[model samples]
Target: MTDAAPSPDIAVLLADDHDLMRESFRALLDASPGFRTAGEAGTGAEAIRLAREYRPDVVLMDVRMPEMDGIEATRRICADPDLSGVQVLILTTFDLDEYVYAALTAGASGFLVKDSTATELLNGIRLVAAGEALLAPRVTRRLIATFTGKGQPAGSPRGLDEITEREQEVLVLIASGLSNTEIAQELNVALGTVKTHIGRLLNKLDARDRAQLVIAAYDSGLVTPRSR
Candidate 1:
């Protein structure tokens, strides 16, 4: 006897004004299993409406658009209590520190450049859908440096002193842009063990996401840039 077919995957909403870009993204998402387009919107207002109506598991938001930009739409979507679980991932051409800071502050789970590969885009959607923050380590570092004035780290150095030795070690690696798989290999620990450490670090630092954690790492001097 034949086996039962798998259930359809979580729905996704693609929001962007550009027709060609939207079509391209839709095709890419369609090629991936476990995901289907709930709908598409060309404006921020429409994006917000569809999100509330369809309640997609994830949203692909472009940073720049006419009428209402992606940033405002993200903020509105996240603010709605009913759409709490809907994850927003920003896809744009610029990874400017300003956008990085705003997106993270607005509760975006991930940020990516438009030039990223289809594989990267698919992975980012999955990661955010799984409730993980998707931020490139280098971008995170730059955001932290800018927020803290780069010339000097913020907060009392002692603020992070409370973190255990192991936790600090993990933060350094995280700020350095290593994913769980990479960190596990580098530290000789299991993947599950690395996740546990990261969870602990997030709590100890009172961080909202990995992007914020990277900021804390720099502010606390746990990670520093090389001299000019």
Candidate 2:
């Protein structure tokens, strides 16, 4: 009989100040299939050290930590050319708007509230490890509000002068929180076509993922938040 192929294991590093929380996360991840604990750190500095040592695929980073905070750690990890493949997923109990924006700006692949279900957490890790941005709906709304609260008018943003009009339309739809499938449906095109446009958008804007593209869209005044 032929043997089945082995599932890919995702290495995760847990960085939290609380001992219990770290233990819980380790247990949860270890119990789940296709995931393994790389190591655990009790402080941001230690997290950075272990990241350099283990080069984990994803870091479950707590927002608040001793020695350094997760934001700074994320920034350092992302800035390091050696750790470019390592993605940081910010885990925090607080849903403060500042933390959300700061984490993303510092290059976090995603953010999750501590109260998230085990399934949600696991899915988030997987999404981020696969080079996708995992922005929660609530978090998305907050991000839009934080920027558009300034009451600035929408205008053309830089880096968009190179893309075609169709690409621009796709980007605006992306900033509006539409998935590729939804975009394809909305544009009356094939899903593959939508993905092609997204790829072109990413290349033209020099964005790492959809979340960064959303930020750029807002920053460039290509999209604005609807007034409540």
The lDDT per prediction is 0.79, 0.85
- How far out, in Å, is residue 93 in model 1? 1.6
Expressed as tens digits, the lDDT of each residue in 1-228 for candidate 2 is 989999679999999999999999999998999999999999989999999999999999998889998989998998899999999998875556577667787888878889999999999999999998887767676667764436454454456899899998998888777778878998999999998998888888888788778877876777778622
Error of 1 at 67 (Å): 2.8
Q: Best-fitting candidate, measured by lDDT?
A: 2
State the lDDT of candidate 1 residue by residue for 1-228, as single tens digits.
999998769688999998999899888778889878889999988999999999999999887778898888999998789998898988866545576567666767778888888888888888888888898765555555555445566664434767888887788888777788989999899999999999987787777677667667776665776411
Measured on C-alpha atoms, candidate 1 has an lDDT of: 0.79
After superposition, which runs of candidate 1 have C-alpha atoms over 4 Å from their true positions? 1-7, 95-97, 138-162, 218-228
> What value does the lDDT take at residue 4 in candidate 1?
100
Clashes of each: 0, 0
